[model samples]
Target: MKIFEAMAGLMTDLTAIGKDQKNVQQGFKYRGIDQVYNALHPLLAKHKIFTTPEVLDKTREERTNAKGTVLAFVTMRIKYTFWTDDGSSVSCTVEGEGMDSGDKASNKAMAIAHKYALLQTFCIPTEDMDDPDAQVHEIAPRAKPRVSDQQVEQLRKALTVAGMDEAQWCASVKIPSLESLPEEKFGGAMDYIKKAALAA
Candidate 1:
């Protein structure tokens, strides 16, 4: 896929939880390397492509701007190698910098760094093997991630089950999770349901 194509593909069907919610209340920053990888997994599978993630190098130093603002800067280089099913040697390797100013926006900026990275890898277009000058280039900035309700519900359930109160379940009590949305998706809820059914 060309650079824009890959970025567009991810933008088109990317699914994340708590990444962006300006549209709702529960919207928050969800940062995870696996989350981004998972979003790209299906696209890779459908398009006969795959990726290998690796950490390349890191550096920490003091950078000062013309405005005389000095800050401790950390730059992380993460590589995402895209591959084809037949292993014909098709891939896009991108390098992006992650910055932090010790503020709330820094949190969001770091998240975007992940999105930017995966998107850029997707954007690096394919080229004819004979064309030596067909390398992809950088593009533009992106907004925060857009998560779906289904993903949110799934996360809620996962968290609840991992930290469920077994005593409450033995007493046949309802655990509404942190949001009290519903117990339908929670696995703990099902555990008790099976117990009750066996008791009958």
Candidate 2:
């Protein structure tokens, strides 16, 4: 029998696993890795399917604050291979991204990749959790400029050296708060600060 046909046979008896994890802020529930693997095991065994995952490539990015706080982000490209007892095999590639403050970013990315790969292959129905249209999204009138946290910190230091009150500086730029300053305004904000310093 074809691998898909055998898989379908297993799916016929598969049960829905409850989403046991909750994201309080997001107000949503999601299945964890344990749930996914638990749901997949019996089906894989029944269908005589062997699954293998390989890391094809990986990349990392990090941002460190002067205060010693660090944020790590990673992107990983992985390949999932499915083999049948008859020597037939199929493979797919998945890219996963994750960010964390510590050393677990790579592990998080790998978990994300595996979850997605299994979700796709098993056609796991995530009830009402899908966006049917990929192209429809709010487009900003202009590209939001990129602002680095380092730049923000530097600006704050410069403001302090100039004896300028941070609140007043933010107000001059029509920003209600420093944190609310948009990326596009960073250049203008910096220019204002430089002019103020020269005047001082």
Candidate 3:
């Protein structure tokens, strides 16, 4: 039989576990990594399916607000491969992101990547017990910022005065080009241009 058929057969007898309370934060309950492993391990062993994850790449960006609060965002590209006992295998690559306020950002991002990879590929289901006090944390995403012609020209002039070209300026701001600069990073770009103007 095919690997996916085998995995589907194994999932038939599996059941979901409750949300982990030990690591709940901000009124939101999250399933821990251990819980996922505990549920999947026995089934995998019994079916002779080997699951492995390889991290293809990872990237991180950090921004600090005026009040000294640091926010970290990390993204990872991961490949999950499932091998059957009969020399058949399948693989999937997934991207996962995690955000945190401190030093554990990378670890959190990796854990999220692994959790999702397994969850999606195996189609695992979790317990549906309801929590009356469970808080739903949701925020609308901000619209992308726009840059005006005047702002772009001003930045160009600043670059010329600083004896630097657009490529150099873009590199300083960690962007591809001045026109492609995101609206959220406008303040930082302006700060960098002002410093360059002074140094010129």
Candidate 4:
């Protein structure tokens, strides 16, 4: 994976774990970016690579609906500069397309964008990063409710099957706790559950 992709993947994985209310803020979790950046340090050390990924371009491309709710999308241009172990480097540009101007894409988006950016290959000296004063702002943005309608639309089908029509499905249905279910029961139980789904 490209440096940007690897970093983004790390951020995505960390963000996934913080979806609970313990991380919620103004419709988002706070400090997720810092957490992602911290996670990146060890990975970077292991990968033997360095990168500088930054926002290169941003534009709002969205249309408001009749209901007064704005459904805006963002076209973010990312620039990723990569350095290799053997004193070589390169710069790449990647585009990130999100749902709206302010709608943050998933951690997967970040990772994929980074990968696309680093697809370019050239060469630069590793010594160029010797500047002690230069600091890398490694972090994911603050966690936010940035999931897209498409994902929700898709999830509607799954949630219906899970009998999660209401947000509090845990209280609505009593099933064997996932932990109590034997590992071997997973496949058969899932198949049975799928077939038993009620019409929504």
Which predicted model would earn the best lDDT? 2
Q: Positional deviation of 74 in candidate 4, in angstroms?
A: 0.8
Candidate 1 minimal-lDDT segment of 10 residues: 123-132
RMSD of each: 22.0, 7.7, 11.1, 17.6
User: How do the residues 1-200 of candidate 2 rate in per-residue lDDT, one tens digit apiece?
Assistant: 46767667766867666667898979888888888998888788888887799999999989776677888989999999888888777788999888789788999999999988888777776554545675577866975555677877978987987789998887777777666677777778877788888899
Error of 2 at 7 (Å): 2.4
Q: Which residue pairs clash in candidate 4?
A: 33-140, 72-100, 72-101, 73-100, 89-124
Which runs in model 1 stand beyond 4 Å of their true positions? 1-39, 62-73, 99-114, 123-200
Candidate 4 lDDT over residue span 9-67, tens digit each: 43343322122223333564322334434544565566656887888777766677677
User: In order, what lDDT does every prediction score?
Assistant: 0.50, 0.81, 0.79, 0.51
What is the alpha-carbon lDDT for the whole of candidate 3? Answer: 0.79
What would the per-residue lDDT of candidate 3 be over residues 29-112, giving only the tens digit for each residue? Answer: 767778888888888888778878888998999978677888898899989888897778888898888877878887888888
TM-score of each: 0.31, 0.63, 0.58, 0.31
Residue 68 of model 2 has an lDDT of 78
Look at candidate 2 and tell me the lDDT of residue 10. Answer: 65
State the displacement of the C-alpha of residue 118, model 4, in Å, after optimal TM-score superposition.
5.2
Steric clashes per prediction: 4, 0, 0, 5
- Lowest-sum lDDT 10-residue window in model 2: 126-135
